[model samples]
Target chain A: MSREWVPFGALAATVILIQLVTMFTNTQYYLTQLIMAALYSIVVIGLCLLMGYAGQISLGHAGFFAIGGYTAAVGTTLNLLPHRDHVLVRMAERAGLTIQTTNSWGVDILYFSPWITLLAALLLSGVISLLIGIPVLRLRGHYLAMATLGFGAIIYYILLGSRFLGEADGIYDVPGFGLPGGFTFDGARNNRVLSYYFVWALVIGLMVLMHNLVNSRPGRALRAIHGNEPAAMAMGVDTARYKLSLFVLSAVCAALGGVFMAHYNGGMGPTEAGTLKAVRYVAIVAVGGMASLWGTLGASVVLNFLSLRGYFGSLDDAVFGVVLITVMLVAPDGILRRLGMYTLRRNRDTAPDAFPVSAEKQVQRGTA
Target chain B: MSSELIIQYILSGVTSGSVYAIVAIGFNIIYNTTGIINFAQGEFVMLGGMIAISLVPFMPLPMAVALAVVITAAVGALAQIAFIRWLKRPHVLQLIIITIGLSILLREAALHIWDEKVRSLPYFTGTVVTSVRIFGAYVSPQVFWVLGVCGAAVVLLSLFFGRTLIGQAMRACSADPLAATLCGINQKNMVTLSFVISAALGALAGCVVSPITQTHYECGTPLAIKGFTVAIVGGLGNSTGAVAAGLLLGIIEAFSISIMPMAYKDIIAISILLAVLSYRPTGLFVRREVGALKEF
Candidate 1:
């Protein structure tokens, strides 16, 4: 049991194996979607933490997603009349490269590479989230949910109707990355595969970070807050700080997911940030069990896979509804709790001395 | 903008807002009885519109609307008996999610049934008087009908509650369900009635508004959202407040166009709902029922 190589007996080892097998499955588009689903798992995890552990709800998470996707998309777009602002133009003129407005959309629309644009977008998204969270996260439960939902509507409309994008139609044929070391990528859709892998990596990294977070002292504070806000406050826990932290964290995760989604989908649309979509994401976190990180990972995986498991693809929403209702009925604490109970009963009759390897037990002990 | 244009916009806001206000009344009725918001109230409007439009070609317009109301009322009553009432013991989050899910089911079913087409039913008066000069901008007769219906609904509801046994029973449940139960009132049955009445309001709204805005499968969502916004703005469980807030929202939306884009028009209603809920949290009319806020 103590051997270093025997780590194959670990939970991480099992999940990694499952994820690998799922990634390589014969369902070709399934692999891509699995990766996309994994990317979304990152956001849902933070959402579960916010709504579950912190007892706050947000209905406009896609606002962050829009910001993220737009960051990458518009960054890559290289808008007209932007590379040379007045100050930049002056700087350029002094360097002898004469600059003047060559395009008519005014000065703000012009110039930058995709990566630089992405950074700016991410920074802007973070700033916007901080501003939104400061006032709005002050509200609790349904009120907070309504506020965020409105924000989602506002952002979605902005993305859709703004001429900077394609309006309701949205931008098409967005540029893809080309290798600097002599490799060329042709189609943006083809580039989607690469973005999928990038998202996979990003999501996995986030999961590990989130998993670690929820196992920490702050995580205990969050869980206590969720169980009873008054009790948490009575214990001297700074409820507001924890609430704000979770809000920022969740927004960042969603924004990162949006970046991946935008690139893979080859330009984001207004629908990506709609209330219905945000609700769907929240439902994902719920169906997966807001209490367990693994439940989200599993639920998202299972949900995405089941959606394409048949011909209609529309049946997936129905399936989601069923799963959501059933899960709420069967395991209010989440599917992870059910799994823990099953395994624990099995272990009680089998390996009593071995430590329990379930998230329910870990959280219970941490709370203790 | 011209005064006439301003008047036109205001009239338009009031009419649309009137529909929302009616729906908000429905929301209030349900909330008062059960202490929870029903997200599917909007679907009642959708079903009402879909059925009324479908039957208008063959039946008398009044009869068609009457039939739609009755059928939608049954649907609403059945929804309560089948899902909301049958949930045994539901948490706040769980109940909210259930309502949202039911709403999606109703909406998607309507989409599949109606096939995403938009059509208009004939106006109540069947008089098409376009561009009646108001302040300077012309308004439609249908707008007046909207105001009339909402006003009538409020008065009628007031009477129903004050003058009828069932209405008084409903008030008892709102006041204290346990006490009402001790008084030999069937609280569950009252809850069902609340759903029925709310659904009927939503359906009536659909029929009334269909003549002007037209009806589509997704019309229920905007309708539901507007109704919900109105309810939230007025106060979550206040019936009178809903009607008042609905009128206020209509007027606000009308004048909001002067300051913001037309697309940002509904934004004001949604903004008010959110802002009020956040700032006050208790809603504009905070007459919480005795022990009514307790979770199941």
Candidate 2:
């Protein structure tokens, strides 16, 4: 029983320790950074599952992130659906949406709940991921990377061109979410601590959920696919379907991160959709042990903290690029494996089969 | 659109497409020999243009251009020798990521040297004032230079690959590195030579196009994507198909502006890229195999 609860206990302990440290030090700035780290961790965790377990690389995860963020932002700004817009009853509406005015509470309102927007964003992102994954997951290695990259580029440009999405300037005045008992989580100065706890709670919940997923039968199949796809296929694993499922899962995770981030910041921007941001996440995943969730948490906290501190300044991006190269070069198995953690390195070889080349080519190379 | 306007757009498309074709050829040269898409291919182009601009005041334009090409080639060779060749157990993903890192380093280095300002070069044939009237549309004389240089490059490259022993050795390395090694061909040297040639071609493309499009530190990434678009759309390892696809992409891009806003022009390229990849993963000009190292 203790063994089962140990991981969750450690996560809880870490959060409590961080809270204690912040409370004692009275350094709220670090709390701000921690909030951002927690947000980014949500995205990185999904990416790790996709890359480390599913044996796929997506240089376009940022596109999903943008979809989530822009969806929430646009939904609120336009008050798309499930919003009371009693004033503009005769205005234009599309996509079978009807503008019905409502003044049930004696006030005309045109505000969609942040919760509903978040849900819509998640649903939209999942659908988009499924649509994208069907064709793209069939590709292998660098071709898939290029295809995903092209997808990302398309998203970035679409955001930059569309006026309704606010184009390059992006959207602002995004509403914050509310909690029970007359409390609001609006990323305010006073309520920051509350928001931080809320976000970290979600993080811990996700980690626990992912831990279970990665230990299940599906997880075993995913590992098999990553270890050797042809062998997995021979064993009756449906590689394509599994890959697509994981792709959708990763996209949904990124979209969730993006939605919360938009609400937290009260705005969304095209910069979040760039390939550079995706690469940064990839770099962070590498810095953490690629296969270790705890390592990802550790790396995200450290790296995102340093980033928010402006420690690297103009060289922040270059530093991430360097980190990626150094990590991949020096410790392909990851930082955790280097730390002599047997559990962290479980079942995986030190030298990873990073190249998912075709079986025929592998056979030829073996002979040669 | 008027026939004359269509002719003008087609001409401009061909001119810009020639540059994309050159970059695509560079991609093919390295990919064929080493099976690595040097993400820094675009940086080589930038370095060529940047180096030539910096040297033009010190020497004749032609000499500056030639020196830039040589220097960029050396950089490419150095990249292979220093980073790629030194990998202990190199894999495809690692190779690609390292090139991405190299590209970042190169871009930052350029930023430190030239800052964020856009830089342009003088037209190869004449000043910006000089133009030629064709089909009632005024076109830059440098367009002719672009066409002439690209045509010459394609013809010369094909001839060299067909007739030259060194070129044949490079081809041999791509076809079967183990067999080539057995036959006394140094695979390492062939790969290095491929990088040099690719870089030189990229540099030449950069220098010629700088007069029209201008050069800047951030230009490499977009150029690399455009080149990749052409290479993939044409079928990855096929140079002839890359040339044809490059022209087609450019024409599509040129006409797309009429239908959409100028801001959407960039979207058009990547949209087409996504469309092609999804609908026809093997590319429009399909082939059974591509890339030099089939084992990745």
Candidate 3:
């Protein structure tokens, strides 16, 4: 347990060290993208657990993320002032779930508190994931991939088609998330440093939680299911339950990231729910080495930061597409695996003994 | 609705349904031969339309479309040889990702090569406004062209598969690759041939539907999803079932617009896809026992 904390400690130190360097170099503005990257990292690490450990590929994670973002966007932006006389609204107001705020145009409005919106976002994401996962998790391989892809496409079309969702324009001018200490999570220059640290703290906390989860009994069961579902079932492991639960968990993680990122950016777009974004997340996971949580975190931060900073320019999606094809073709296990960076425990977990000899050999061979 | 309105909706639905059927056939050919669903299947259709549109200025319409089919077929064969042929026995996940990547790459290439503007081939026999009265409804002449070409392609494909030695060899490869190899069939070439045929078929359908739907770089993804829905609804490898499913989906979509907003048109097909996946994954037409024998 003590050893398990070491890498996280190193990660924390590195996080602070980067901040300090940026401050000293007067390049603190870079922290803005870093904050966004950290949020994306939350989604990536969760996906690593599902794809790498649980052996389930979800091509619709962006849909969950968008669900969170859109929920937060809609919850806070939809003024309840007009409906304040309604019973539920008055009750909610009495319960202190509603907040009185002013929009960008200085018009007064009653809206749900950011905290309430966050809760709603997470709950909605959890429910949607559960609904999608129940039947979707039953599929295997190509069928699973297509079903999830279809789900993502559905979410995108709905977002694009719904007038209440702002149609193709999406929602903008989303109010900042307010914290207890009067700190607001937004893209304002004055709030940059605080927002950066706040986002990273949340990310680190989630990573620690995930790390603990991955080493626990449920995590072992997940790896067993990944190794051989039939064998795992024969051993009395509830494969379906484990897969479904992990799917929901990962989806909730994605939604949490989406909520915070939408607040940080002060807007959400339909493109956030698009299939390309989902594919991009998968590419980062593939690059990070599916089973290595730390690798996924590192890859997500670096790649997403670069992407957010406009380094790829007009060729952004194209670059990720190339990365996916090249990585899968050249290193199916991932770039980290190619570099021999996986831990001994991971190696042992995925050793030949854990899987059928032929499958294990094919994965290890790595080349046609 | 009036009978004329119903006839109009059915005609429109059949026009789009035939296209979806062709796309589903494209998916089935590769799936049967290799047990891999080529996610880039829709890109072949997009390429056919784009290439034909580009070529129309230099040559006659028929020649341009023929050339486009050949070129797209070559692209299909090249893609198979480059990315898939050498993979000894890739996992399904890897193949899915590779094909997805290929689709994106193809879309991006089309974007750069022909700009982002939507383009379409001229109608085969008449202008866009030219209509034929059929059972009290006015139908575009292009509708007949789409149905006729698609029908002919399906009949020709069935003949090729049932009668030709090479096509029989390909079927044998799908049945049992080891036995086919023992019988001196070149399995690799058969796989490449499957890709070529599917691509050619998709291209033909794309050209026929181009005037009605218009071709855009981003259109392939949606078409792919809709075609996939039809494929699942019809059963994975059943060409005849695909035609029925495609027409059903198309009519549902056509009638759906009367009740729902046009913006939500895509949701109709996708909802059916999810419902079918959850309840009858073996498809509406396939027997449970037969479906159980085939690997998903």
Candidate 4:
């Protein structure tokens, strides 16, 4: 049990070391992109669990992210002043779930609290994923990919076509999510350091939770399903239920990331829901050793930070495309795995406890 | 709607449907030979149109289109050789990601080669406004070109598959690769040939339909989705079913405009894809028994 905590301890140390180095160099502003990347990493790790462990690929995670972000954006930005006398609004006001704010034109607006919107976002994405997963998870390989792609296209079209959702312009001027003790999550210059630490702390907490989950019985069942669905089923594993639950769980994680990201960025756009974004998430997971949660976190932070920093410029999407192709072609297990870093089981036939073995040792063992 | 208006919608639907059928056929060819859906199939269509558009400025329209088809077919073969040839036995997921990557690369290349502005080739027979009156409705003469070329291509393909030695060898490879190898057929070459044929077919469709639907760098993705939908609706690996399903989808989309906003046009086809995938993944034409016998 203590051995399991070593990686988490090392990760926490690295996070602080990076922060300290940036602070000493007076490059605190770099934390802005890091914050965003860490938030996006949540979605990546969730996808890693689904694709890597559960053996289900989702090409529509961005749709769930958008659902969450849009829910938060719409919930906070849509004014309910005109319907203040409405029973629901009055009830919400009585319940302290509505906040009074002013628009840019100095008009009074009553909006749902960010906490409420966050809840709404999570619930909406969960329900949507459940609905989509039922029929979609039944497919395998290309069919599943296409169905999820289709689902994403539907979400994109809806986002682009709906006026209430702000159409192509998306929702902007979203209010910051207010927390206790005078803390707020937003892109405000003054809140940079706080937001950076806050987001990273959330990510680390999630990592611990995921790490525990992946080592538990469900994770073993998922690996079994990944190996052979029929065999897993014959072994009394409820394959469908496991796959469906993982789908919903990962979708909720994506939506959670979206909610925080929407609040952090102070806006949400339809482009966030695009197929390219979904593909990018998959590419990141692929670049990481798919089943290695640590590898995914590291890849997501570095790649997304670089992308957010405009390092790739106009060639951003192309770079990811190349990475995906190159990784799949050269190292189907993943680049990190090929490099002998963070080696998980080489194949499903190996014992589950044989992970963390160095590549050379594994090779020697194989020969012996 | 007036009867003429309905005729106009049907005509428009059939024209677009023919294009979708062609794209679906492109998917079916490679899928039959390799059991892998080339996600980059639609890029071949986009490349064809883009190449022909660039070439038309230098050469005549027919020559430009023909040369474009040849070039695109070569590109298809090259992609197969460079990316797909050497893998011993790749997983389906790996192939999907590879093809998807290829599609993105091809799209980005098109973007860099041609600007983002939408472009199109001149009509094959007439100008954009020159409409041929057909049964009380004015239809673009190019519509007939699309239908004629697509139909002729299908008929010719059937004949080739039925008569040619190489085509028969490809059929054998698809039927059973081990047996085909025992029969001295090069399975790899058959896969590459399948790609070339589909690419050439996609290019031809792209050129014919360019005038009606302007070509853009980003158009391949939507076309690919619609084509995949048609492919599934027709049942995977079934070319005739693809043609019928494509037309049906196109007509439904064309008529959907009257009931829904224009921006929601793509949603109509995709929703159909999802519905069919859920309810009848074996396709509309395949019998339940036959579908059950085959693995999806």
* Listed models, DockQ each: 0.22, 0.44, 0.44, 0.45
Q: Is the docking of candidate 4 incorrect, acceptable, medium or high quality?
A: acceptable
**Cα error of candidate 2 at position B210, Å:** 0.9
lDDT of 3 by residue, B130-181 (tens): 9999899999899999999999999999999999999899888877777989
What C-alpha lDDT values do all the predictions have?
0.69, 0.80, 0.87, 0.88
User: Model 4, which residues run further than 4 Å from truth?
Assistant: A343-368
Question: lDDT of candidate 4 vs native?
Answer: 0.88
Give candidate 3 regions above 4 Å deviation: A343-368
* Per-model TM-score versus the true fold: 0.85, 0.92, 0.96, 0.96
Chain A of model 1, TM-score against the native? 0.75
Candidate 3 clashing pairs, residues 3+ apart or interchain: none
TM-score, structure 2 vs. true: 0.92
Better of 1 and 3 by lDDT: 3
Question: What is the TM-score (0 to 1) of candidate 1?
Answer: 0.85
Q: How many residue pairs clash in each candidate?
A: 3, 1, 0, 0
What's the TM for model 4?
0.96
Q: Please rank every candidate by lDDT, starting with the best.
A: 4, 3, 2, 1
The local distance difference test score of model 3 is: 0.87
User: TM-score for the second chain in candidate 4?
Assistant: 0.99
Worst 10 residues of 3 chain A by lDDT: A359-368
